[model samples]
Target: MTPRADPLTVDVVDLIGTVVVRFHEEYEHAAAEHSLTGAQARLLSLLAVEPLPMRRLAQRLKCEPSNVTGIVDRLESRGLVERRPDPDDRRVKLAAPTAEGARTAERLRASLDFAREPLGQLTVAERTLLKQLLQRMLGITPEPSQNPEQEEKKGGKGEKKREQGE
Candidate 1:
């Protein structure tokens, strides 16, 4: 049989799946080391970026708000998280990390120690594109940001075009 120019989607998906599974397993181990469940660890990681309302977090975590409440309650009991009224909307409570929680989160993030050096070679636009593509493949929405195409159009068209030409 003649070789195809592009790889089959199934093959690509299988490879991506393998990578995701491996990453998840490592994350779970790291979470366990910190005395947290994978779900709880994930919640902490999300909050580390910024405080978010329980409902919003549930939406991002793809779980019911009630589940987020329980998780938050547990974290609160451990002094890993705290609920504070949203300054803009007093009715809604945002989950913010405590100092200890932030420290734990930093430790957890540092422990991953995975192969990230290769990513250093990618240009900013290329890295953004890679991140967006992975998020798409994982069925996650890409966060709002200027895309690589937009970046190219803005000031790097010639540079990108030259790279593409090579």
Candidate 2:
């Protein structure tokens, strides 16, 4: 006889699986409407922030460099992204989004509202709590912001004095 599976474990797995599948489907549909494959859209989104070396992009995307090269090749063909030599290291190639790519990425974000509708149902406090819980679950430490307003609110006033043993 097979060992019985725990009901709670099964429920948790099902819930997570459902959410992942739904989100991916919604994103893929949005990408298709924009004439982009899901992988290409993701690559454009990643490059929008800043140019990155192919190796770094592969590491972040959790894929091989060869896979990234193929995606980049297609994007480049569309005049959405470009490959440039890294300033500090000429030997390394960096991928950067063109003006059109940035606009496309912005449009993609505006069109994909899958999470917004559901998350809007929660109260502000609930949303904050949920964000904290998710961050904790992912083992991420929230970083202090460089903005003066945020720094002041986070008790930056006494931080220096305390550090100096005042």
On TM-score, the leading prediction is 2
TM-scores for all candidates: the values are 0.72, 0.79
For residues 8-83, what per-residue lDDT tens digits would candidate 1 score against the true structure? 8778878778877878998999999999999999999999999999989999999999999999999999999999
Per residue, candidate 2 scores C-alpha lDDT tens digits across 22-129 of: 889989998999999999988899999899999999998899999999999999999999999999999999999999999999999888888877765554445456
Candidate 1 regions with alpha-carbon error over 4 angstroms: 1-7, 115-129, 135-166
* Model 2 misplacement above 4 A: 1-9, 144-166
Q: How far is candidate 2 from the true structure (C-alpha RMSD, Å)?
A: 8.8
Residue 27, candidate 1: alpha-carbon lDDT: 90
Score residue 9 of candidate 2 by CA lDDT.
76
Candidate 1, overall lDDT? 0.85
